[model samples]
Target: MPLIPMKQTVTRIRTEGNEWDGTKTEIRTPMKCAINEGTKLVRSMSGSAGVQGTTSSEAVSSAQIYFDKLADIRLTDVLEYTNELGITRRYPPLTIEIKRLNGKPILTVVSV
Candidate 1:
């Protein structure tokens, strides 16, 4: 039997600059290492089953719950950063989806 692998979808947030004529253009820049690392970790472990008796559906459900909690934790961290730096910064919450494939669980985030 083949074990199904998990999938991850991530959004790229970039700053666009507008010229004098009001034309917008994308600026190519490297993403933060922390963000990239976090995304990779979330993708790799999202579909992991905790115990042997757990079913694929259960694994998917667990993954969804884990992602939700992670989102809340991220929000708290952002709030703390804003408070400490006295600067207003907005971070988008991750959108995640979990499903079963070939008797295994899969996790994915919807692209925005």
Candidate 2:
């Protein structure tokens, strides 16, 4: 027997091409997803250095969200997270890394 898990409903927004007037179009779908977040320190290049080419070390500690769903998510899509507070958060587009578990998609979104 296959194990059945509970599901959560989330709004899926995607770019659906442009209109004849040269305007962007979007497609929204209501689906089930699981969301989680974590924090860690990341190191990235700041800017161009001098002729010496000596770069400074900087550590940024920030939290990132990991959203899991059975649908395909795009980099240009915005995730709407719903909470009990009746406040809907519109998440900006970020680099999405996807992994599959039991033939389901798990999207890991990070802040840029």
The digit string of per-residue lDDT tens for model 2 on 57-107 reads 555433244454434667677767676567677776466665567777545
In order of appearance, the predictions have TM-scores of 0.18, 0.51
Model 2: per-residue Cα lDDT at residue 38: 34
lDDT of 1 at 1: 19
lDDT of 1: 0.29
Candidate 1 lDDT score at position 47: 37
Q: List residue ranges in candidate 1 displaced over 4 A.
A: 1-91
**Best of the candidates, lDDT:** 2
Give the clashing residue pairs of candidate 1, or none: none
**Candidate 2 residue pairs in clash (backbone atoms < 3 Å):** none
* Model 1 Cα shift for residue 79 (angstroms): 14
lDDT of each: 0.29, 0.56
- Each candidate's number of clashing pairs is 0, 0
